[model samples]
Target chain A: MMETDWLLGFAGGLMIGGAAALYLLVNGRIMGASGILGGLLDGSDRAHWPERLSFLAGLIGVPLLLAPLWAPETHLTGNPAVIVAGGLLTGIGTRLANGCTSGHGVCGISRLAPRGIAATVFYILAGGVTVVLFRHVWGLI
Target chain B: MQRNLFALLAGGLFGAGLLVSGMVDTSKVQGWLDVFGAWDPTLAFVMGGAILPMAMAWAVARRRGVSLLGTPIPARAEPRLDHALILGSVMFGAGWGLAGLCPGPALAVLGFGGWGGGLFLLAMGLGMVAAPALRRRLDRLPA
Candidate 1:
């Protein structure tokens, strides 16, 4: 099961990279999920609303359509406070930095972009530290 | 019309990949982050696999200069590292550790993540709305 998990992850990752490649080659845009959604929410990229909306329609719509086939689960925490806090921080942080895992982690690192590499390092380090503190030490999560 | 169509196709593929990659699974994500505990190295494979084709795409992009669709390709981001990048990443990481859901997986899981997911999305949206104000305040501070 563990072996399969990694294999599946790799295959799926290839698909993700392929999607990003297609987006860049054909659409001429970075496939940054947060930036796409953020622009729509903040009305900053109004000129490209159609492109953003179309992308989101697929992002949300495909998963819903495929739910019957796979039934994807998040296993998110039941604590509303934790969930809300997590969401707010993710939202604010991604916006302030102008990127997230998809934007900085995948796209940026692939191109060896300095900013992307730096952001990935910090976030992963911070995430590791937070997990250690919250889960290991405090048992809060 | 073609641009929107392709965008939909790309988005659909990306969402499906997230589902297949187990990125939508909070436990897997948290497990990967939990380096102190029983760590899961699955995410590293995912990241590695994702980067391969993307690197190739960047190379192609460099040569082509414009997308096949004729739009100009975006230039590489400035290499300058700023405080916002560092600070925002730290906060994002903390949130990721807390909930195990980043932006892409957060939305991808909405189909079945129930009210908890909905609440998270709502709060995330509100945060995005308020981020600009916070950024302005941060900018006012000395570097």
Candidate 2:
């Protein structure tokens, strides 16, 4: 597992950083995931369909290419209500931050954006607090 | 030369890859991290799943001396060890350990359709919204 940890982190980091890098390489826009997902909602891209389509396609399609053929299928950790709420909340969070972990943690940090660095720190801090709240404070998990 | 579309596409692929590899699960991540205690190593696959694409991009970008977006990207050496980096990693670990999710996996886990992911997302977003304030605070602290 230790061997795989570095490998997996590298891969996740690569895929994320690489994607952002590629986008920067090809597009002038920051490959901030929130911005891309937001474009879908803001109806801003009504005039530019190809850009949106390609972006959406790349996000959905790349994982299919990278997932291991025999990797074990994992199940959700909790009930349905937890997953749905989690998604909506995350969506809002990603939007507010102007990017998700990939955008901020991976791409933003790599770029040395002070905001990105700060954002990533808050994210991790929040995450830690959340976990403690749920598991220890609330005794929910 | 910057390829906005390409970047979006690359990010999408990256996100999907995260889901595909099961990197989004908190238990999976913690379990992997706990190798020092019990010796489970499934997380390695998740780490690998992410690196390949980055390497490819680096290789191409270096060889071509141009980003796929058709722009020249600035290169900086790896950042030096600093308080922010150290503090950030510890925070990230704590968050992942407690919430059972990080940003990548936390967001990706949305596909599962449950409250854990949803609440996690909410708090995660809240954290994001609070980032500016946090930054202000962190900045005021001594370096």
Candidate 3:
């Protein structure tokens, strides 16, 4: 009854965890997603530039690289305007919170930071609300 | 030991992985999984790319190697499957499925100047800052 999407979730978690681990292994940092983005905002991230550049490169480049063999026309279905709006809001959230789910949920919580744990909870609740507004209330989904 | 700093380095690599893996580009991501159009499976391959480095790192850490940042590598911990984790995951899934942007990929997108990345990053930040106060209220309830 409570079958988990273990495979997908694990892979997702693995990516996050692996990145954290790898970051720790190489740079000796926690890989907080928000912090990385923060540095990008102020242009103060010397230690993570190459890594971030490579990571960002990999994010889009990887998919593009695999396009020849995989889905080459990968794009979104929603209104482009909606997506831009969403991305903008999330950026603002990251700045105000000083972290994202990856920072608090994946990395901070993993290290047993009480604040991270708590923040992670709230993050999910907000997501749930968003879905309800967009999907259930607005019938967008 | 500057545990915080070590975490910083690890984060950078994690970010790199997210980038190279195309976890940030929602359009490409939606394109990859889009059923109506060109259903791309590049996400699969990008995920595959992580194997080597992760394996190498795991082995080295397992053998008691110190990270380049001088922190003592610890054993990998299994993620706890609890209510909190589950709840957080569901939220992540909801946002990802709806916007096709996770925190890692979203940030990566910003770096690469992907379309809509700015908006996604903004909401993500807002959600984070509000988490603490929201959590405080949740704590008042009986578990």
Best by TM-score: 1
Put down candidate 2 lDDT per residue, A14-112, tens digits, no spaces: 556565656655653456555565555645446545665566556544544444542423344564444444444454455544555655655555545
How close is each model in CA RMSD to the real structure?
1.0, 6.7, 8.5
Model 1 Cα displacement at B113 (Å)? Answer: 1.4
| lDDT, candidate 1, A1-141, per-residue tens | 999989989998998899899999999999998899989898788999999888888888888888789877788999999999999999999988889999999999999999999989988888889889989899999
Runs with alpha carbons beyond 4 Å of true place in candidate 2: A44-49, A65-68, A72-75, B1-22, B29-143
Full ranking by lDDT: 1, 2, 3
Provide the lowest-lDDT 10-residue window in model 2 chain B: B76-85
| Candidate 3 local Cα displacement, residue A50, angstroms | 3.7
**Model 3, span A41-73: residue lDDT tens:** 545566656555444444444434444453322
By descending DockQ, how would the candidates be arranged?
1, 2, 3
Against the native complex, each candidate's DockQ, computed on alpha carbons, is 0.86, 0.23, 0.16
What TM-score should be assigned to candidate 3? 0.55
Scored by CA lDDT, what does every candidate get? Answer: 0.89, 0.53, 0.52
Model 3 Cα lDDT, one tens digit per residue, B1-143 = 34444444344545444543445555544443344455555554443344434545555665666777666665433443334334444455445546767667665555444445556666666555444454455446555
